[model samples]
Target: MPEETFVIAGASLAGAKAAETLREEGFAGRVLLVGDEIERPYERPPLSKGFLLDKEARDKAHVHEADWYDKHNVELRTGTSVASIDRAAHQVTLSTREPISYDRLLLATGASPRRLEVPGSKLQGIHYLRTMADSAALKQALAHGGRRVVVAGAGWIGLETAAAARSYGNEVTVIDPEPTPLHAAMGPELGGVFADLHREHGVILRLDDGVAGFWGAGQVSAVVTSGGAEVPADVVIVGIGVRPNTRLAEEAGLDVSDGVLVDQSLRTSDPDIFAAGDVANAYNPLLGRRIRVEHWANALNGGPAAARAMLGQDVVYDRIPYFFSDQYDLGMEMSGVAAPGEYDEVVYRGDRESREFIAFWLSGGRVVAGMNVNVWDVTGDVQALIRSDRPVDPARLADPKTPLAELA
Candidate 1:
């Protein structure tokens, strides 16, 4: 077995960032980065946002280009997957049926889009946005616009795709069984605002509903609702959520909960193996709990931390939860962890109707979490207050007149 060689599975955000950090930290060990996608590490956030609108937007996510990867001495193996991991042998089996030795392993296999398993769900034009190919397919359908598009899910991906479809002048409709959209991520009170935003933009909105199945001979022609309502469509997009890709880990007998269970150090059940990104069920210090965060920030931040730990450097992933979404002309930035109905009240710092706002989840004058829209600059302050757990006047927080820095 080759000693001091580092191997990482899944070369998306987490895997690539981990490799970059490992080399930058002066670790001269041999590095191997494996990815299922046949492309170098590129940003995913733009796939659903900018790339849908501009073709050249692909350059936005080129993390380390081919030249850069070569200069960094990072061995990037794309279009390959870890079929199984042999912890005892310190080897990982590749999809090509090759076993490679590793002193340390980081499983960063991010996630795949959740699919509707119902009949006709396999029909053509029924798509899921998770990869560059997925985006390209949808983007081609968006060209010249005017196609009737039905989106079956009001999650971040679905909504953002709907926005992109609308921007291209496509007739887009969003359907979800939730009473309000994004209720799980953003609560009902805030999720309702999102429902309004879609409606105001002329996208047909369906709440408290779901798809029955697809209609057509080959390609999707229309969407049938759970309650027997029929909506005509030329394309269907489903973005319910993502499932952590852990089949290889599970088959290898690694401990798996909702995700790969990892300690504060990002190590898995087997000490030689580690996991991060959407695949890592990591311990959250601020929340004092084990949580799986499905965001670019967590994947980017936690990946390097896991790499440092593998390289014998003590590191802890303790950055506040950070994520954002762009839809319509509005941009949202939010941080912290506050559960629903746990807070006694919410404090608003900006106007709601103007499409700019920052609301805090407050309990007994202590800020626990926050929701911000078009106020990206203040997410840091909101994060500080939520983590500080210090007291503040509710009236001051609610009052837009008060200076935000005063609360900190």
Candidate 2:
């Protein structure tokens, strides 16, 4: 009998945690984790929140200590990229022309920030927030304050970065084509709340307009909008969105849609191969549909589930979609999928005027998703309501006096 070799591509949060799980599950076989980044696996939330504000230390985002991999006998290959996977030969070829054989493989290649296609986009000072280096550079550019910071897109990334910019006393302006900030995520009902929140914090909002182009000599000095208005900017941050990285899996003859297609067990089209993290559009039993989550919690939990499945354990990846964001004095946690038009109405408990409340999205009188803003310790109860799939009285739900647990 020969010893098995397990290979994981993309040294991201998912890949790193998968390696840790394999060892903890007593897989003594050769474990190799390869990534293109020079830095070790790190969480991304801090890049837009705490770290960007310089409130969190630089070393706090790492998945494991600098020495954890070496001590655990895991082969940590940083600054190395997987160019292709030869499925026939059960091997992955590196960019450096190195080939490694693997009995089983995991692809957690994550996603990349989508860039603007407008003119002058190549100008200096136009930034995207995806990597640690990007956050560091943006922090340096805004930390001094008094700079004109123009952010394109009013999504979580854009708004959070805008808050950080304002925290430093910089003049911050956020532009988005949608009617309200977070329009796509929370819909118009709750999006209005965020719009007011940012405005109250001294962040300017330019809604219903899109960036048409940039103007500058060598670095960005201003942004021209579709509405024919020019907004001055010393630094420009683009946070539109991201696209999943599925080139490796796609080229390997695996099923690919918006992301790599996988079953409930995280198994790809090929049995010996699997995908997780932002790259895997996995079938979720709880949702009764396929969902590809780009949030940090998905990566944090998906990796371990995939590892257990690789060990021949019965695994069902049905975690409720979850994510969190912090801006200025507000902190929020959202659970379950609340895609546009999927939910009929949103019910609120607590005071919306004070910005302390739990908003529930219900369809057919059943709670599909819930978000708690400036409210703590109700995540489990919120999740339970979503998982129970029971219809509830809207009046009772709206009553703050009614405990969420009783409704569940």
Candidate 3:
């Protein structure tokens, strides 16, 4: 059995965490961590905010120090991609034409940034915030400050980048097809709250708008909107969304839908193979539905869960989905799963206008999801309420005096 080797494709947050967990769980197996990025596995959350704003925060993005991987006996292979997965052979072929066999394999291939197919997208000075190199390039561009920055897509990354750009004193204009930024995720009401926050910080909002094409001589000089209006720009950032990297799994003939379909234990259709992180559309027992979350929290928690399952430990990843975002002076933490239009009513506590409040999405008097804006020490309570599945009184939920713990 070659002492049971565990091969992990993609040196992502999940993959790295799995490697760590394999050893922590008393699995004395050979671990091969492969990745396409040359850098060691690092936390991506800081790339858009801390690393971009402060020079000191650059190294803070690393998940672990350089020696830590070696100390843990993990063979870190960067700048290498997985060419294919051989399901029957229980092996994976690397881009370098090397074959690695595994008793258990993890596919934490994650996702790639959706590229803009519009004309002028190939032009220089246009960027997408995904990798360390991308962030470094954008940071250099924003360092001079006073550049005309047009951020297309009002999603979380777009909004965070716009906020960072504005902080650098760049003339920033954010565009999105929705009526308000984050309308789909936060709903129009709560989304409007963010819109106001950006406007208050001197950010120009071009809502219900999208980019038509780019217009520039060589470098990106302007963004042409669908309305035929040209917005001047020295730098343009596109943050539409990401698509899971499921080519290997699909080619391997594993079950694939929106992402790699996995059971509660994060096991793929093939017993020996597993998937986690942003690429796994895992079944959340708590929600009683299959959902894929592309957030820091999932990648952080899912990795260990998948590892434990691979080790034949009885585990179900039932952690309430959670994610937090920081933009300008506004900071928010959210837990539970509530898609757009899924909740019947939004019960608010504190002031929404002032941006210090907690908004709960209740379905039939039961809290499905909750978000705290500029509010701290309530995420645990909010998650508890959601997991308890108990109906909460609307009046008490909306009342700031009613402690979230009491509701839980």
Candidate 4:
């Protein structure tokens, strides 16, 4: 009998993790992991930190050692992209004109960095951090330091990249339309904490400004903002955001929203097809809504959950959405999803001024979201609080003496 075949698109963290789970779960199927990039499946978190700082090896970034794929009977296809999905025939057409059929298909296509469309964007020194190649190129340019580095966007990628560049001794300037960095995501009070952190590190914050265009003879020389002000720049990194790679899923006639729509089990409109990672706008039963998260933790956990669901296991991809960031001396872990205007109050424990605190967003006396900065070993507690959805006294919630477990 022919082996049951499983095809996974976009050999990313989610893809790799799924492949690993398939064998671990005794699937004994033919696994084909396809990717458009030339490298093997790898983790992307280190791209902005250790990899950029030259403290991480190229091999260290990979999800598995080189021999792992072959030993597990997984077919690895690098530098290949899916051209179309033939849902009717259960086959995928590749860019190379090859067609592969699958009993189960997983789309882990992920997302691409949103680009700036302004004039002079074609200039040579402009960069976007999305791939290993991008990280390597940016690291090479920032290695010498003393260069004028202008980072556009105050999102996680932008801020992390700025921290890496600054650590290399480069004079850095960060631009964003918000009055302060991370304002939209974390609110102004907590966002101010990050702004102050960057300022203390000697990084200039160009807040409440929009980029008009770029200025250069050939390579980028400066970034022109809305007020006709030009910030001299030898290199510019844009990290505005990312758009999920949902075209193939859309073409395949699956439900597509901000991302590919998946049920609570990560199953798409077609049961044989599933989506995970950044490309999946999966329903979270715990949150009572669908959310598309582009962070590492989602991919790490969602991959296995989706795989288990594919195997017909009784499971749901309901893990609390979480992500963490490291900038300079700051380490932060955030859990739970904050629906727009859902939280009525922000409760704080510890001292924000001292950069050691945990902030909780409470809605109807229940924790909706929690963030711990420069605080460790409490993410599990925060996760439990959000999961329990139990009411807690605001005073106790803000007291460092009150254990997070006790609040639940």
TM-score winner: 2
The positional error of residue 185 in candidate 4, measured at the CA in angstroms, is 2.3
CA lDDT scores, all candidates in order = 0.86, 0.94, 0.91, 0.92
Candidate 4 — which residues are off by over 4 angstroms? none
Q: Candidate 4 residues 1-408, lDDT tens each?
A: 888888999899999999999999999989999999999999999999889988888788999999999999989999999888998898999889999998899999999999899999999999999999999999999999999999999988999999999999999999999887876566666788899999999999999997889999999999999878899999999999999999999988999999999999999999899999999999999999999999898898888888898889987788988989999999999998654476878899999999999999889999999999999999999999999989989999999998889987
Error of 3 at 273 (Å): 0.9
In candidate 3, what are the lDDT values of residues 26-105, reduced to their tens digit? 98889899999999998898889889887456778888899998898999999999899888888889999999888999
**Candidate 1's residue-wise lDDT over 60-145, tens digit each?**
77777778777888888899988888888999989999989999999999888888987789889898988888888989988779
Task: Give, for candidate 1, the lowest lDDT window spanning 10 residues.
Answer: 336-345
Better of 2 and 3 by lDDT: 2
TM-score, cand. 2 vs. native: 0.99
Return the number of clashes found in candidate 3: 0
Task: List the lowest-lDDT window of 10 residues for candidate 4.
Answer: 336-345
Order the candidate numbers by lDDT, best to worst: 2, 4, 3, 1
Candidate 2 error regions (>4 Å): none
Clashing pairs in 4: none
Global Cα lDDT for candidate 3: 0.91
Worst 10 residues of 2 by lDDT: 180-189
Model 4: lDDT of residue 54? 88
Quote the positional error of residue 332 for candidate 3 in Å. 1.0
